[model samples]
Target: MAQQVRGVIARAKGEPVRIETITVPDPGPGEAVVKVQACGVCHTDLHYREGGINDEFPFLLGHEAAGVVESVGDGVSEVAPGDFVILNWRAVCGQCRACRRGRSQYCFNTHNARQKMTLADGTELAPALGIGAFAEKTLVAAGQCTKVDPAASPAAAGLLGCGVMAGLGAAINTGGVTRGDSVAVIGCGGVGNAAVVGARLAGAAKIIAVDIDDRKLETARGLGATHSVNSRSTDPVEAVRELTGGFGADVVIDAVGRPETYEQAFYARDLAGTVVLVGVPTPEMRLDLPLLDVFGRGGALKSSWYGDCLPARDFPMLIDLYRQGRLDLDAFVTETIALDEVEKAFERMHHGDVLRSVVVF
Candidate 1:
């Protein structure tokens, strides 16, 4: 039977999201239905509503979520009903070239549910990142549901579903940050701070946080930054270099992906250092740099897609770390809100008022 659940939906572009009754269809082949317990309101959600991602109107917003699998479809073996899981946008298709090469994290053919959830009038709605979860229940590809330890609270555990994972993965995976390596992360938002924590987890000796806001910098400090630079008040490159003994860090991860910040990260690393870009940018945004500099940089300049995460592998590992108290995933939750609070949460995010405003169902 189809279940009608209260979900936050962006009925039209550039308009506020509303709590709409969305009809969740029964799972089809290789799909599963998740009973959402909590979902985080990410900047990407707002971007979808603003038409930044696509023209897919009437989007079912919200992605960063954790829930229990309520049902599964035919031929589903990756996940089963009643499993506690974290919802992910990246569900690697084993047949993709990337997966064929054993790099499932970069799977080119990742997918979502084959069936669509609809509005009361039967208009189909596009799920954000293919995992619309700002509701009591959501249907997703079975591979999109990564089972993890159920001990973690839904409010905190869900963060790993998106921004938090991106940040952490940028440092640990893309930057290859390790013990004794110095890392400077540009941006102190949710993703940025997660990179901070990721750096710390990887045993980075020095973690420098660069941001325009002081409060966010403070937040980053709590997340495990060894130094904080208010980029609005000073040159971030110089500050990062000064903190790293005037030689720059070993790895610089751009969490606030922009051309200027990319440049800052490019120059803020020591010789043979790595620069990782995890922050997303607008399409109109482009970067122009001296070709010589690109060649002159001794290490790789890389971008982290969904934090270069292999959900099945990384999610369970992270959850274990969270349970062991090594990774402080719970600290990332700034506020807990209900389903109707997404629009206001975006406002808070705009002003940098919260690290993360999670919707607790």
Candidate 2:
């Protein structure tokens, strides 16, 4: 039988989300039902509310989630009941060209449950990121559940489902930050701070943080940024160049996703240095850079999708690192909120008042 559960849903564009009695169906073949323990309030949810992602209104918000498998449909051998796991948006289809090429991180075809979770009136709700999890229970493709250390806090572990993973992957996976490298992360939001922490984890000798907010810069410092640049007062590119021996950083990441920040990141790196863009940008945003500079400056210009991560491989390792005190996952959780508080959480996130407001079930 389908389950009736309380869930957060954005009924229309630019409207506040509401808690609705949602219907989650039993898992079908290749799918599993999970009891969500925690779901982080992410900017993406707000974007969905604002119609920024797409016209996929009546969105079931919240994707950064961790939970336990409650049931599985036939042929779902990947995850069984009682398995503690993090929900991932991208469940790679092995036959996709990207997966077949072994770059499953860029999997063209990802999996989601075939069944739809609906409102009381039988209106279908489009799950945010294909893993709507702002409820106590949600259904997902069996492959979307990545088993992790059960001892880890659900609030912390759930973050790997999205933004945090994007930031860390921006530095470690996309930017290829290495030991002794000089890295500069522009924008000290949750994602940018994660980049700072990831740079530290990657053994970066210097991590230069840039942001307009001093509070965010301080947070970045706490997360292992070696130097801070208040971009409001200082020219971030010049400051980064000065911090990195007047030659700019080896790798510069733009987590802000704005063209201005992207331009700063482009010039804030050494010639032939990498620039990883992990920030989500609006469709209307355009990049107008010099073609000559693009050719002359050299190095990789990359955009990270979900941090170019393979959830099954990265989630467990990162969780273990968190458990061992190597990764400070707890630091990212600014507050624990109830599901109903999601709308207010969006307000705080908009004002840069919190790094992450997590919904603890």
Candidate 3:
């Protein structure tokens, strides 16, 4: 049966999102309908609203979500009705060349549901990141539903779907942070702080948090940063280097994607060290660098997409880590809000006031 549910939708470009009735079709081939329990208001949602992502208006905003599978379509064996799951935007198609090469993390043919969810006026809503969970219920590819332990709270566990996973994955996967490594993260927002936690989890010996904001640096410290550097008062590169035997950190992650931050990350790592860029940047942004330095600083310069996460593998493990009180995922949830509060959440995000304002359905 076709179902109509209230969802937060961006009706026009640069306009605030409105909660409207959206018609979700029954689960089609390899799709599933999930009853959204909670969804985090991510920067990507705001980016879509501001036309930064594209001209896809009337976008259904909300991707970081957790819920229970309510229905499934043909050939959907990944999950079944009543299964508690975290919704992921990347549902890898195993036949993609990237997946064929055993690097499913870069799966070129990731998928969403084949069906289009539309408004009551019959306008098709392009869901943000292809998994719109701001609604009370949403339709997505069955593979997008990653079943995790039900013991975790929706507000806490749902974060693994986006920012948290991206941060954790940035350090553990992209940075290859090893035991006894010295790690530093610039711009200690949700993603950066998660990297701090991930570095700690990876057995990093010294984790340094760097940010212009004292509050964020303190927050990063709370999340497992062994040291904090206020970049506003001190040169972060010099500070990070001083903290790590004057050789810079082994792994330096830039959670703020601005070119200035990116350059800082480039020079703030030790020789043959890794730099992970987990932040999003605008198209107009550009950076300048010495080609010789790129050759001299001989290590990986990598960008982590969703933390190189395979939701099926990372989400469950992260949830269990949260359950065991190891990951401290709950600390990332600064507030719980309704779907209508998304715009306000953006305001807080812009001000760097809150880590996350999650929407509880």
Candidate 4:
């Protein structure tokens, strides 16, 4: 039987999201329905509301989430009812070229549920990132539900579904920061701070955090930054070099996603160091750097797509780390709000007032 549930939806671009009664059909083949326990209000949700992602209006907002499996459809063996899981947007298809090559992290064919959740008027809702989880219950591909330790708090664990994972993966997986390496992370937002923690966990000797905001820098320090630079008043590249023995950091991660920040990251690394771009940029954003510089810099320049992570492998391991108190996932949850407070949470996020304001059911 179809279920009626309350969900947050953006009826149009540039409009505020509102709670609506949505109809979620029973899972079809290879799908599962999740009863959401907690969902984080991410910048991506705001982007969806603003039409930054696409013209996909009437969007079902919220993606970063943790939930309990409520039901599973035929052929869905990945998850069963009563299992605690963290929802992910990417559900890798094993037969894809990338997966067949043993790099399932780069799976070219990821999927979501085929059935549409609709409003009472029968208007179709486009799920955000194909895992709209702001609702009381959301339908997703079985592969999207990665089972994890239920002892973890829903609010903290759900964050691994997106930004936190992106940041951590940017450092540990993408940047390949190793023991005793010097690292500089630009933009000390939620993602950037997570990178600081990642570097610390990876045994980085010095973690330099750069940002225009002092508060964010302070947060980064608590997360494991050894040094901080206020980029607004200082040249981040020079500061990083000075902090890293005049050569530059071994790894420079640009988490701001702007061209200027990207250039800063490019010049803030050692000759043989790595530069990882993990920030989300606008379509109109462009970079114009000297071709000579690109050739002269003898390092790897990489873009981290979702931190180049494999959820099934990373999520569980990270949760274990969190449980052991090695990872401070709780620090990322600044506050918790009800579903109706999502708009206000977005405001706080845009104003840089909170790392994350989660919606708890």
The most accurate candidate by lDDT is 4
Across residues 1-361, which tens digit of lDDT does each residue of candidate 4 receive? Answer: 9999999999988888899999999999999999999999988999999999999789999999999999999998888999999999889999999999999999999999999999989999999999999999999999999999999999999999999999999999999999999999999988999899999999999999999999999999999999999999999999999998899999999998999999999999999899999999999999998999889988899999898999999999999999999999999999999999999998898889999999999
Error of 2 at 21 (Å): 0.3
- TM for every model, in the order presented, reads 0.99, 0.99, 0.99, 0.99
Q: Write the per-residue lDDT of candidate 1 for residues 1-361, one digit (tens) a residue.
A: 9999999999788999999899999999999999999999999999999999999899999899999999999999987888999999999888978989999999999999999999999999999999999999999999999999888899888999999999999999888899899999999999999999999999999999999999999989988998999999999999988998989999999988789999999999998899999999999999998999888867888999999999999999999999998998888899999888889999999999998999998
Better of 1 and 2 by TM-score: 2
Worst 10 residues of 3 by lDDT: 10-19
Steric clash pairs (candidate 4): none
Alpha-carbon lDDT, every model: 0.93, 0.94, 0.93, 0.95
Q: Give residue 119's error in model 2 in angstroms.
A: 0.6
| TM-score attained by model 2 | 0.99
Clashes of each: 0, 0, 0, 0
Model 1, global lDDT: 0.93
Lowest lDDT block of 10, candidate 4: 9-18
How does residue 197 of candidate 4 score in lDDT?
A: 93
